[model samples]
Target: MKKNIYYFDNSATTWPKPECVLNNLKYFLNEIGGSPGRSGHRMSIAASRLIEETRETVGKFFNYDDTSRIIFTKNITESLNICIFSLLKAGDHVITTNSEHNSVMRPLRFLEKKGLKITIVKCNRFGELDIHDIKNSIVKNTKMVILTHASNVIGTILPIEEIANLTFKKNIPFVIDCAQTAGSVPIGINLGKYKNCIIAFTGHKAMLGPTGTGGLCIGKDVSLKPLVFGGTGSKSDEDTQPNFLPDSLESGTMNVLGLAALKASVNYLLKMGVDKIREHEKNLITRFIEEASKIKRIELYGTKEAEKQASLISFNLKNLSPSAAGLILDKKYSIMCRIGLHCNPNAHKVIGTFPNGTIRFSFSYFNNLKQIDYAIEKIKEISRIE
Candidate 1:
């Protein structure tokens, strides 16, 4: 008998998107196909309407009143790059956390070479940050404070709401890297009130959208220079780019097909409810951790408190390299997971897994208790081997 395959690597990208997303993707390609805002034709108008509707849906989902402030990009990485490059200039000091993914680290590193000052606040071994460290690091010249809503490796949820309030009080811009938490965790942002906060999100993960779909919700007080330049379908009569919310940052052709799928996925998530999905995944993680704790030689990371973390867990078996165990899980047990640094070397360092990272099992709403039990049993078996 062939063994069934179990997927546990949701932090990389969500698997098995909702049927509505797939159906709409097909429908857009088949029926409504046109470049949005380019022409007055019926097909073009329909496509444009779909894009606007998606923008509004995303805005509503994030509690942002102005849908025009939402700007789409290929992924969260691009969104972060646009924000980083556009907001910070030479000699500007920026604050970030040590647990940030390379999407934020790499850009900040590049900017450091360009005469930008960066302060990387340290997080504890459990991936929890001290709010005081962030506060003390803020100097008069601090241009912005960028942080991840949750650590991708260990899955520790940060106190973004408090940090946002801190930045707002300090009169600094707060940018949140919500690549891992968006659609999975509630981002308490009242866009109408908080004009200094920005939320960057990717659609392929918890949003259950296509890979190429992601965007950023710009606050009212924030403005970013265009990372790319081209035709925005509007203001074609003039040579300069349009001075507007989305069009200023968004140029060239939009990802109509991907956005269509994203719109459908967002609608499904709205109907299903994010809190319900979060609770289900939390149960899976809690169950996994409780069972895995009983196994000898299993060293887990993070706060170990399910409510304090997201749906992911990272740990190692005794005398087992994560890479080797990952291979065993894939080839022998047919369990898929992520191992190694997960693109956040700083997070690994904080957890004392610098060179060799830990095995990561990230759960999703679709995962069941049976799958978690099986994975825990297999991990116990693996730990007993040596």
Candidate 2:
């Protein structure tokens, strides 16, 4: 970790994860460093227990009673690919928003080239999309409605609850990409919302866990064909993949250490409360918007209203490239930010900054108002150049 760096790029990945989370990682490495669901050894059983406990807690987090259906994966991208490739056929169509991370867009684009029809609904210049636009985009052959809960670039929170209702009413399956809002905000979807929807999330970003940890909260009604077929710990005699939840998606050795850390992080979030975490980030964004708005050369993107956003802000300086601004913030101001399209070309196009991307500052639970104020001062000082 950089000693004096102010991390404002948490939307890409969080920093200074809770001590409990780190302790859990240490616990895994020290106490139980064995593969989950593989052997009958005590360490292996302990690993399995950790994974199960995390799944149950996550189920409770989303208000899902059945934890068995919670499938683990490498991250949101792998989870989305599992659902997309498993469900969508060659002639099927998928409807999604204009502001999607490459995690969703990349798989959809690859599937599109492989003969899957896709219709991307456009959001406004502020990265706001209307539910009616979704209704307008739906066609007879549409199979899935993939949604990004919040824009990674602009932090605009979408109307997912309404969209979930629409998908249920139309008997369409929905997949929400929760990469930007998972642990930082209050979202109790997956099993609580529409039964036909699947929620994909990563642990490293908002969940505050290590990388190589993430999964999909698969709903009761959705049955996905396994993308990776290999040996499951259960029914080792059978050559085919087992028809179970984690076993179905998880083929190779499980990341018990990572899941142990994730369990600790999720527990910490449960203790602090998602609402409180959300409020903290909102305060940071509010101060960020309030202070940065005074800079004459800076044009901020996303919803001007801080209450309607996640924990991120996107903006551009007049005449100064986003790369240059980010470099200056890093080298000169000791600040960090994400610069470029942010893996969402469609979002940039919608926000009218396509090829040249905006500088994105994503917030996390650990960020404070003082950091926000400092970042704002740095931006203003940088923009005052002759």
Candidate 3:
């Protein structure tokens, strides 16, 4: 809401989305107001075309070609829940990492209480996970493996390809929560090689799209039961839910307005290139870490190496709570950042910042080195406080 501040909280949800996203959303409201797949009228057909085109764009962005397998949801959390709950049941074993957000952890924990077995592969304090740990944790009953593509708290990118390979060999379904990496990092690079992987992504974080827009780029090998069932505009004669792609998983009416903006946002990403965006944000991370590390009292978390992480950095000043520093950065310096566990307490525990979490500064493609310099100066002043 406050556009005047230096926004560095892109990991939670990207702010100041691309101008095209806003423009297309306006166009959808003004020009195309119809429910996709629910009607055969001109406006409905136009809206359906937008959704399909956006699906194709998302599939291309991930290097995944099967657009039908991509099922839309409100967010990555819902996507992850559908994968976790639908794929696993009692007596089944699931594997995950310590760097996962609660989206993946909560569902697994709930299933664990219902007679499901869970193996939490531990990551190092740097939030780096070893693929060997995942391999060794697998058993005959291991049904699914769910984890985050990157740490929401420390911005550490996990060894996704390696883990996906392991799961493919084990014939286990691998569900990836890509809430932090969807538009900022290139995903599904190995989807062709790994058939058992499902990538759940949110549109708000790095995709430059509005909230309430996300979905699963499901692999051919994975078949999930519908998490929600309702009118899919098909098979109307029968009360039974349709057993197919997209429609089967999508019950309610599609978010045509949000998808119109998402279509524009992802097209913009494709044009700008995710790799280019990654490099730009990497520069910002490198600049901020280089200067923030100079303050002796500041305790930086994660691998500090810009290449090994996403565009976020977490730190704590000696004798200063993260909340206090966050307030000073917000009220005094007009810098917007996230503080506390960042919805991933396990990550904070892995990085030894549990309970009282660290201050997080997440960057985006729009961020620059000059903004990093200003944030560092403010952090330096804040660290000197008693």
> lDDT per residue, candidate 2, 259-336, as tens digits?
888888888888888898998888888988988889999999988778889999999999689999899999998898
Error of 2 at 206 (Å): 1.5
Candidates sorted by lDDT, descending order?
1, 3, 2
Model 2 Cα shift for residue 214 (angstroms): 0.7
Instruction: List the lowest-lDDT window of 10 residues for candidate 1.
Output: 1-10
What are the models' TM-scores? Answer: 0.98, 0.97, 0.98
| Candidate achieving the largest lDDT | 1
lDDT of 1 by residue, 1-386 (tens): 23488889999998868889989999999999998989999999999999999998898789886888899999999999998999998899999999999999999999999999999999999998999999999998999999999999999999988888899888898999998888887778776777899999999999999999899999888988899988998888999988887888889899999999999999998888899999998899899989999998999999999998888999998768999999999999999999999999999998999989999999877789999999999998889876
Model 2: residues with Cα > 4 Å off, grouped in runs: 190-193
Indicate the residue-level lDDT of 248 in model 2: 82
Clashing pairs in 2: none
Angstrom error at residue 177, model 2? 0.3
Model 2 TM-score, all chains together: 0.97
Q: Of the candidates numbered 2 and 3, which has the greater TM-score value?
A: 3
Provide the lDDT at 211 for model 3: 96
**Lowest-scoring 10 consecutive residues by lDDT in candidate 3?**
185-194
- Residue 246 accuracy (lDDT) in model 1: 85
- Clash count, one per candidate: 0, 0, 0
